[model samples]
Target: MAGDRALLRQALSTGEETDGRVEFKERLSREVHLSEARFESLAAQLRHRVLSGDGEATYVVGVTDEGHVAGIKPDAFSESMDVLNLIADEAGAHLDAVETWGTKDGIVGVATVKDGGTLEIATDHLIVGTAGHVDHGKSTLVGSLVTGRPDDGEGGMRSYLDVKPHEIERGLSADLSYGVYGFDDAGPVRVDKPDRKSDRATVVESADRVVSFVDTVGHEPWLSTTIRGLLGQKLDYGLLTVAADDGPTETTREHLGVLLATDLPTIVAITKTDLVSAAETDAVQRDVERLLRQAGRSPLSIARHGTDAALDEIGDGVVPIVRTSAITMDGLSTLDTLFEQLPKTAAAGGEFRMYIDRTYRITGVGPVASGTIESGTVAAGDSLLVGPVQEGTFEEAEVRSIEMHYHRVDRAEAGRIVGIALKGIEETDLERGMALVPKSADPTPTRRFKAEVMVLNHPTRIHTGYEPVVHLETVSEAARFEPLDGQLLPGDSGETEIEFKFNPYLIEPGQQFVFREGQSKGVGTVTQCIE
Candidate 1:
């Protein structure tokens, strides 16, 4: 079943005409002897392949020149990737994706590469979501880390997120905020004027790799809001914070459950370490490790092990722990390195679909819809549909223009968050939970769905007539729960029918959701959508 039994050379030749965008290599290595001209020729061939595929190319590794499914050793496969990556760079491209499979001989891999030179530079952009209890320094840490500005022992640095007057006065983040910073050839590019839209856009434009932060709410009452940020956006990682002075709390565990439940790789940042003694910090770190362990995660101390270990092990059940302080700026560089080295892992394949997380009206630009591309890509002049706003119907719309980080771009791909100016919809018509999709998708909004769910935490048993707000993608609305078994208890897994008490949404089977009300909380996967 390795590489799904790749076709033989003869079989491949029986197909349609070759476009030269696909290549096969038994193995490759820098150690191989080749003259400068020969190497340049090879690189040129790779470049041509990338250009032919319109900024993407495919390479099947561990296959012979004749296309036989001959696998190679694991080490050989890695060396081949290294050489291929090098060649791609030389060809002004990058090895964007590499998937492998085990075989009798050894291993087989398929690499999907990127075209380095492009107006839409999203190949290396990463979206990070932050979650923690209030006063845990989530926003403050982000502000300091991106702007390279230390806090003034108050909420001064938090202003980078454009905190609201009430938020500033209360010294608590009540909604999702964002911060942008990135790295280039030389080093990290700090955003000095994050409050200014143009300055943020400039940073995104200049950086070779960009890291966008989606800072979520942490107060207990705003758990739903926090879940929206973590699950709504196509995030690459979750930065769960724990203040050194306070260590872990109930809300921290709640947030962590949501983060891990969504299968998002996480990094624990122990903030405000400067205010605590080393002994205190150690104790807090132990608490965090224990908490992570209880959540079935291996806590990795980046301070002890290193960056390589974190990058290589994080997705494989290991969660890195970093001690950070907004004031002292400790452990910030480690985060920067981790972020820089971390690969973009969001899903990039499928029909274009973006959930509307925010909508705003610009004085001159008219209506702008903003959200991360969940799948596929969108470009200016593309005809799309925005929907479920009226009687489960989708309205036709046109993407007049697109903006990323305040910078104008012709198009944006999956995993990149941007604002798109629409031609056929009013700003008031757009709702946070609505979606933009290719007209061909013909999406349907649902008022009810059947799901397999677990009571993550609940004070009592749940039966019919239980009303809770369901958070699926960007759709958050109160829904009534009906248990097929008549009743369900805390920690119990069961089948339930949930119907949106209000407006319908574009709900499809296999979509994960979280619901909460009062002190009850749970997560589930939709098995069927009933409109």
Candidate 2:
């Protein structure tokens, strides 16, 4: 059933305690004939409900205030929605979306109303990326958080996130995986069916705020994949997991450096607390605090000062540390609270730009490009350019549809990971690192650029003609580096010229990139682009 009538009725019911955010109406057409004073009162009530819901509210059509689902005719439902929209307008809100279901008697639907200015102000969405050493409970912790289920203490919860058959067989993640959970006014929306995209999308649609987890590979050999997950997306925060028993390792340090190098505010979760003694937990906490300070970050223990203080200073160089146990469910509630209140860091203003991280094709939908919207907004039917194809050319395309976490949406703003069905190009033409922009922007691709590089590690001096693989915004290509200030040694910083060995990309100034060759690794920021 697309929309089960029974489920819809239960979800829309206020139960014993009346919900101020949810209203019910058999039909709104009859309300328009009310006297001016009565209409004014109704409008005032709707406005109050929207404000109480933090700029949004839900209305159940074809239902009564007493919680009875007395469905209405299709024609009446259409007129009711129109009247509801006018009433919402009177309350300074607008109809955002609606979902309907068919019943024996008539139809029932839910209308999502939002304040007119909310789209321009702030959105209730956030993204967090997981990074840590292998078998450090990164996936287990995320699985438990998103699914609201405890691990069996032997990698049971991990199965919820490690979707690939090979990954489950190896008991390790070999590539990037994603999980999502959200918070409504009541609390966290526990997604039992974590494997289903539809279930995840339901959580996104029903919640007041949502958090998406980009689970990255943690093994030493897959360091490149971890780096890509951390730097490629528009993540608002980082969740670095450390098993309490094992504490931090060399790989943990590497992952932490990448998290901090990208200036992502991080939350350190010391997992498996149930397996360690109280004294041992204290020791690990001290070690974590020392490492964070060594990396120039202030560590705030959420267990002591609480999530309120941590959430207030999030993204301001302060890292929150929480002791957690997937098996025992320790510190999970605090984590949920912090995520529920964390403000969105990425603003939705500026020119639209998205780096295609993946692509797909549907039998009847044509080509689809999926990636995080780095900035600006995109709507269905908008004309955009997709590429930097082999020749660095962007081809014209129209956005046939846009989806976020499998939920179809008319528009998507910055900080959202979306899959867009595009017209006017073949699926084979799209590749990772291609940029999608407005056709009028006249975007140009570049093969060479100037950047300020900081050598984090190197066996020897980096001289001109040094070729290393550069990872920049989903594009990993071999690039030749020439230090403008002569040869550079480890721990040194200098302006360098870089040229890609293969195809050009839509590189821009101020973009960050990481380059590495075996044991050597360096980070840089693009200062100038030469087409």
Candidate 3:
């Protein structure tokens, strides 16, 4: 039964039998027994056996000589594909080495299941985040850091496609909103002011790094995207902005929901400080401390505020807050000083990684993928394996072009939002969960994942093997999360070692995902993959 060439060849080489035709000859006996019915059954059995991990090594030597016939019904191509699909699955889950060959003589198959290799280590932080409630002055703080001003003019209405403040305010149709600034490794310590006092913006560049200070939508509905953007890259320190005058609100609380989840270090910026009196500033500081305590942070916890007392309180890991009137140009230096003190990103480019947080096709160019460089360096023509695992399958992809910002370049370093033109990948293949990786890493496609999730809203119950939309980077997909542990209730922080039925894509560990309710509709990240 095992020596059956027809069945063995079909499953191994082409993954399907040749349309009800089983040709064979008996060399030694001079009489061939062609059992077509037997061949059909044998072929199915052979495919099942190979997928079931039965034989160590099998080969179809040749046909015997005498031709014979036995009647048997054949299956459709789709049905045969199902069998091959099973084989591909088994190969991914277990087998390390396998090959199949078909020749005029017959078919041949070879397989050796060996131990898998370790994934590539990331040299830089994969993702970072910034959060403050709606109108919490998140945009103002980002503007102050990048443009050296407090008022970005239109506030949250800045345009993503156009970098100019005026153009952005005019509602320019662009995919992203953020100003890109490149700096040298030496650092930009000096802070200047923008000409338009109304805009209150200044930009200074130094060396080795580029900061595109992004002012994203801080509203609750956009919170998922805000978190998604922050989760897409590893950060130096997460900056949380709060207006001294507005204090804490419900929206601010929602911002805190995402902040407290990750282990990343954070800075608290008290904007609109000049709007209130000195005593009121101190009181606002106190209120911030109280809010921090309520959110599980200690009041005595050192947060960056603009004052010697606040700085002293922060000690080495200080939370120095600066009081800045984007109008008066005061405290701009303090902001610069804070940025200078920011910890550099972990190492530099090591492993090749980029999470596509945003992507679009330029008017002339075809398809482009954009996201912060998670790790390693990417140059033009360098092959990048990009895709995500959804519903327990790995969808493969490749990048055609890689660029920094809008400029056409051969390659880009980690820690920047790169726009890449993917070759051979259509718009369908590119999604938010997808991550670019080096060719060395053996990609694993899985649908089940074990993770630790802190429920943001109440009534939190993610059912076992329940399918939800997983949002990571710029990719989103319908994925099922099967809990290895029991049900997780709201505010109940526990570990669920569940199987992730991800879409057919490859996702690495340490990537952040937000879960939503439906296909390409929800948000979430996979915290762990248990195999």
In order, the Cα lDDT scores of the candidates are: 0.84, 0.84, 0.48
The residue-by-residue lDDT of candidate 3 on 57-146, one tens digit each, is 122222332222221111221122223223323333222222333344333333332222111122221223456765555555554555
lDDT of 2 at 405: 77
Q: Model 3's lDDT to the true fold?
A: 0.48
Write model 1 residue lDDT over 1-531, tens digit each, in one string: 133335333334532225667788888876671357767887988888887778878788777777777988866775676577667767888665456777799877777677873235546889999999988989889999898878888867887784688987787788888889999989999988777775786687788999999999989888888999988899999999999999999999999989888889999999999998999999999999999898789999998998899999996678999999889888998999999899888879999999999999653234789998999999877999998877878998888667788665667999888988787778889999999999778787889889999998888799899998899999899999999999989989999999999899987888888988887888999999875
Error of 2 at 425 (Å): 1.0
How well does candidate 3 score on lDDT at residue 289? 72
Residue pairs clashing, model 2: none
Q: How many residue pairs collide in each prediction?
A: 0, 0, 81
**Looking at candidate 1, what is the lDDT of residue 490?**
96
- Between prediction 1 and prediction 3, the one with superior TM-score is 1
Best by TM-score: 2
Question: How are the candidates ranked when ordered by TM-score, highest leading?
Answer: 2, 1, 3
Model 1: clashing residue pairs?
none
